[model samples]
Every structure is written in C-alpha cells, then in structure tokens.
Target: MPYDFNQQIIQEFRANRGKVGGPFEGARLLLLTTTGARSGVRRTVPLGYLNDEGGRMLVIASAGGAPHHPAWYHNLRADPRVTVETGVFTVEAEAAVLEGEERERLFARAVEADSGWADYQARSGRVLPVVALTPRSVSFPDLPEGASPPLHADRLDATLVPATSDDRAAVMAAIRSLLAGAPALGADVTPALAHTGGVPGVWVSAAGGSATGDGVTLYVHGGGFEHTQPALEPLMACRLSEATRRPAFKVEQRLAPVHPYPAALDDVVAVYRSLLEQGVPSDRVIVCGESSGGTLVLSALLALKEAGDPLPGAAVAISPLTDLTLSSRSLDVDDGRDVISRRVAEHVTAQYLAGAPADQAPQSPLHGDLSGLPPLLLVAGTAEVLLDDTRRFAAAASAAGAEVTLDLYEGMPHAFHASVMAQDPPAVAMTFLRRLADWVAGSRARGRRGC
Candidate 1:
C-alpha cells in the first residue's frame, strides 16, 4: 500500500474503467475523491466496494489493514461531500460512516461477499470503517433526445379552477370529475364498504382474477390537505395492484381544513393497524401515497414506530411534501416549472397545520426521526417544486441507516407518474411504475428470505 504503488493502481483503474491487473484483477473497484481535511485539496483513492440492500455503494477504510485510519476517511469526516467514479460514470455523493449494529450488519455482509474483509478487520484490530456513498443526484441515461418541453408550460394557458376553503363541495366535485375523466388502464375497481378499521376505501385489483395474499398495499391519495375523493384512489391503486400482484387498499382518510393534523394521521395508522389485526403480517404490507398523501405514508411509519408496532416491509412516496415549512431551495428554483406554486403550497400547509407546529415530527416527516422506518422508494420529477423535499428526505433516511432509493425523472412535472396514460410518450412514467412494482415485489421476496 505504498503511495507510489497506489498511484500506479489509480492510473490503471482510470485507464481501464475501474479494472486493474495482478491481485486486484476482476475486483469491484471505485475511485473515491475527497477534499483533504487540512490542506483542502482533492485526494483520489481506488478502493473495493459492495452494494448493500439499499442500493448504496459501501466502501471500507481497510487501507490494506493499516494500524491508522485512512486519510480519505478523515477527509470525509471533515466534509461529507465526496465524488465517486465507478467505471465510466461519476456521481456526487454524501459519504456517511455507519456505526454500531448497522455497521456490524453491513460489515458482516461485506465479509460474506469477500472473506478478505474479515482478514482486514482482524489485522486492523480497529473497527473497519464502512462508508455509504449515497447519491445526491441521479442522471437518467435513457431519456429520449429532443423530447417535448416541460409539461406545465403547455398547460399553463388551460383554465385554472382553484379549489378554495369556502368551496369545499366544489373542490370535491372537481376532483371527482378529474378522476372520472382519467383513462382507466384496465383495472377492476370494486367498492369496499366499511373497510380498514371502519374507514371507507376502494379495492383496486387486476381484471383477470382476485388478488389473494396477506400482502397488500395501503394507498393514500394526494390533494394537498383539503380534498379527498374516492374517485382518485382507484387510478393509482389499480396500477399498484397490477404491478405488485397484490390487492391495493385505497384509504379514504379524513382531509385537512376540517380534520386537521393528527386526524388524517390517525386514520391512516388505523387502516395500517387494522391490516395487522386482520392477520396480515407487518412485513407483507406496503404503504404508498403521493403529494400530501405521500406525507401521510411517511408520517404513518413514524407513528407506527413510536407506538412499538411492527413496521411494514416497504413504502413508496411520489412527489411527497415532506416539509410543511416550505424551506426547500428547489421550491423557489423550480417554482415556475411546477403546477403547485408558493401561494398554493403555503395555503395548503396552513390548512394542514391548523395552528400545529409546522416542523413537528410525524406531521412534517422531514424533521422526524427516520431511523427505524421501513425501506422506502421515493419518486419525483426534476421540474417539481417539491423535488427537494423528496431528495432531502431520501438523504436523511439514508444517513439514518434506513434503506432508501430515490428516482428523479427529467423534465416531468409534480405527480407526473399519475399521467402514465395521458402523456404522448408514457415510457418514462411506465418505467417508473414498473420499477416501483418490482421494488415492492422484491422487498417482499427478500422479507420472505429473511433478509
């Protein structure tokens, strides 16, 4: 592990797309560049890596079993920001060193993958450091060239029927009409009377047959905090059911402006609890939502954890509003490209908070303890104002040692996944849903395998 020899390997790695000959041939290697803690200079080191269950790249500070910690580890501690190069792609990532039980578990997995790590740990005597390279931004390589402009720009001239506090009935009617107008992508919708702990909801499943399993998806629909329409639930539920090959329970939780703060949170938690009470194992359940509903999905997980309830296998949030404080930088930067403006976001937040602290945990989950939550998949569009909400939440969750995957679609608007059937080229949206479904299914399978 001499400096001159390391530099030779680094040169070989760069020349060979992260591959090198001799002892490191066919090894999984990545180039980590960190700013020096003292000198503030960029330092690059080639290291081996292991992909964790959360899809994060794990790099060990073995330093070839040196007595002292690696210099790059010190740099990362001083500044978490780091650049990662794997093969031909380079990504900006935040480096987080795992600790205690989480560190032990990941280290064991690494040792299992490669026994050399155990020898490194034995020789070092020090706890071998494990660093998670959590991506800050993901690039979409498959995006079509010469694609259409942003979706919101084309619809800007369309009629704007504002949903107001005074016109609650009008808002409900408008939401129903919008849902009714959406093209049904071939899903069997059935009404469920007094489902989910006496809360009414809809059951969306595939058309061919009834979905049979303890595994179910509890879906909460998004309409800021004011609007809750049964019509909107099935559109996404059917797709979810089709994707996961399980029944989707679309919960009609109480909305804001009337049943503020804990009411909606309580109702969603009740539905989740009811599923557990009805013989559905916690690991077989997956909670999912969008927009404000996405907020609820995260909040419910926090509440469930607080109550000592068994957590679900996984959860999905699409364009979720994680911060009611409206403090994300993207809110101002991406405002014009999104459908929800600052004025609308502020009004919705006020209605939802209703005198409650805006930064309260389980209300605005961004401020909550994200440690014990289930594996999460967050999907958002680059142009959406709430894009930062998703990104920040994902980062926090990952930092807290929770499994999280964030997918950002280029040039799409807020909740654009809902526009799967409406867009001219629905390829991106379709791909997103398919990936979500695959994640859910895979998570369930992993649970069955005791991972």
Candidate 2:
C-alpha cells in the first residue's frame, strides 16, 4: 500500500486544485469537504460531477476504484449536510442518495460525463452510490445565481423488459449457434486443445489480456443449469486473447437443471485450481461468465475463498442472475424490456436448487458475504430487467470493500453481448473487452516487475 510519487501529483491536483488533467476533462468537478466519520476532522476530496436536466450537482460515491467507500462517503451518510467547493467558489448543500428509477436516471447522466464509470460499475458488484447535492436555495457559483430551476424526476428510459421466461427455446438456440461458430483468431491468439479427461467435450479457450495486466478473465457459459457449450462464449474469449495478449480460458463446466447447482460450480473450482497448480499464478486470473455462467463464477469464487485457495485476480459477471429468489423490483418494473422474464429465472432457480432455499448464498450472490473477493466487472443493459440485479450487486460489493465496475448500455436486451456478431451494441462491448484486456495485461506486467 505504498504511495506512488508520480501518482501523488495526480492525486494532489485532484484533491487540492480540483482540476486534474487526466481522465476528467471537459466536465465540471467539485471538492466535497466533509468531517471524517471517525476522525472528527475535515477531509476534502474532488469528485467527478453529474447534473440532471436541472443544475443540481450529482456525484457518485466512487472512491477511485478502491475496495471500499471513501471516509468522506461515510461521513456524509452519517450527516447529510456537506460543503461543496469547485474551482471558483464554495456552497452549502444537502446530500440525497438516489435509488430505483430516480437513481438509474441520475446514474445514466453520470455515465455520460465519465463513460469509464461503466467500468467502475462493472468492478464493484454494487450500485455505485448516486448522491445529488442540491443547494439550499441555489445561490452557488457552479450554477448561475438566483436560479431556482424547475426540477424533474430523472426519467427511466423506456427500454427494459422484465417478464421473459428463461426457457425460451429461441434464445437458447441463438446462444448455441453463437457458440458453434469458429473463432476468428487474431495474431496474438494462442491456442491449445482442451483436455477434459473422461468428460468428453470440455473446451478451454484462454486469452491473457487485461488492462491492469494483473487480471485474467476465466469464463463459463450458462444453458439452464445442465447444458452449456463452453465453445459458445468464444466471441468474448477470443476478444480477450486479442486484447490482453495473455491467455483467456473458457472452462466447459457441467450445466444445470440436469447437472444442477454444485456440479458446474465444482467443475469451475477445479479448473481455477488447476490453473494455479499449473504455474499460472493466482493474481493473474479473473473469472467471468454470462447468465447462469455468471452465477457459476460467483459461486466458484466463494467456494475457493472458503476452501482457502488463493483468490483469482478479478472477475466479470454479465447479466448474472445472482439472486435465485427473483425478488428484485426490476422483475416487475423491467418486465417489458427483458428477453427473459422472472418466471423463467424462478423456474431455472427452482430446478437448479431442487429444494433448497431461494436466498442461499450460491443462489443469490447479492446476499453472500462479498468481502475479500477480487475486483469485478458487471455489464447489463439499461433496458433489461436484470438492471436492478446488477445495480444492487454493485452497491453491495462496494459497501463490502470490493472494487467493481458497471456498464449499463442505453437500451439493449438481455445477453446483448452474445449478439455482438450481428448487433450494433457489440461494438461497445468489444471496446469494453479491449479495455479490460489492456488493464489485465498492465497488471500482469506490473506484478512481474514486483510493482
């Protein structure tokens, strides 16, 4: 935890001068000065700002990709009254935590200001806190004086569907077909045949690419609980290989409904452990998955931690049905925009759990103790009903001191990343994957140099 002298300049500019030249340009910023929750002393930190149709300043409680909320965030939660300072002037305002539709709307605007926030949301398995700072009476310099602008509720974009069944044959078929297509190998894509022992058809596609360089994404696919073709997730896997230049592996784990719950999770754990045993270092692997595969990623991480295995570098969960209870508000609110409905999620959960409680940790990652897990990346469509699931998961992860990133695309449906081959949004997804791979590659290089 030693400080980097080079990073010190950037941090100093961010904290004191309020005009850091990297990553946050062209956007207005403010210094939120708050008394420390425990220290009882004043602490001031500059934050990226978001304003709705009204000029009210909105700031997310993202502590620069840290594992926990900054001390100032705790102070504000304890006392909502805080002071705001910008490049020119200061003002007094009240902090209001926005949730649900209001929270989502405000969050979208914040993403517009810093698209990288989508990565932060993906890293934290929790909804990044969105707090609006409204001046007591609008006499602030950041906003023109005497402007008591009319305020409107941030509208939830009307593009979510919440009621599709998980058993839709067309959706499942599409997933299978995508998996069946041969990967378009890149120059850096290194490959080796998957050896699954007597399991017959387990394939391992590994790509070693990450923005941080210290992370790798190990993926598992989902087809109900019993049937998933690991080869299907090649679109993402190959992209990782091209991006990180490391290795990205898609472990063909057993599926559910038939293989059910622990069967697939156990297989994933074995694959992760095998990688470490094979000399691939623990800090270099990140587990990733889509749908039930995302669930397997979470479950495997938990089990690994419990079994005293060294945790992987990080993880990514896309449209992960982390909660089997199907109790999130989005199941109803997003019913129209969702490709898979709550009924389907519930049915799949029941079949997977057989007779276990819906809120079991393996069944609902949101309810699990998320402390000590590696950083995570979460991607979901603003229109899909699982939006709430991602939001809630990110917030909880943040509260538990884990770094998380979330990307909520404007109006895509569920598993939209799967359709990247034939869709517009896939370009955005590729951009995200490339960034992720670069980060992981950097992390790996840093780790080797003992950084």
Choose the strongest candidate by lDDT. Answer: 1
Error of 1 at 211 (Å): 7.1
lDDT of 1: 0.73
TM-score of each: 0.62, 0.57
**Candidate 1, which ten residues in sequence have the lowest lDDT sum?**
154-163
* Candidate 1 per-residue C-alpha lDDT over 1-451 given as tens digits, one digit per residue, 9 for 90 to 100: 7889889989997665455899888576788999999999999988888765444789999988888899999999999999876642356679999999999998999888789899988998998999998765432111121022222221111011111222333323333445557655466666332357877788776633332344777888899978965544576787777776677888888888888998999999998888878777677777889999999999998998989999887888989999888987668867786778777889999998999998888899989988877778888765678977876776667656667666665445677766543423245556667777667666656653101
Off by over 4 Å in 1: 1-180, 190-194, 207-214, 421-425, 445-451
For residue 233, what is the lDDT in candidate 1?
59
Which residue pairs clash in candidate 1? Answer: none
lDDT of 1 at 181: 71
lDDT of 2 by residue, 209-292 (tens): 432343345767766675654434555565555554555666677665667667777788887776665566677676778888
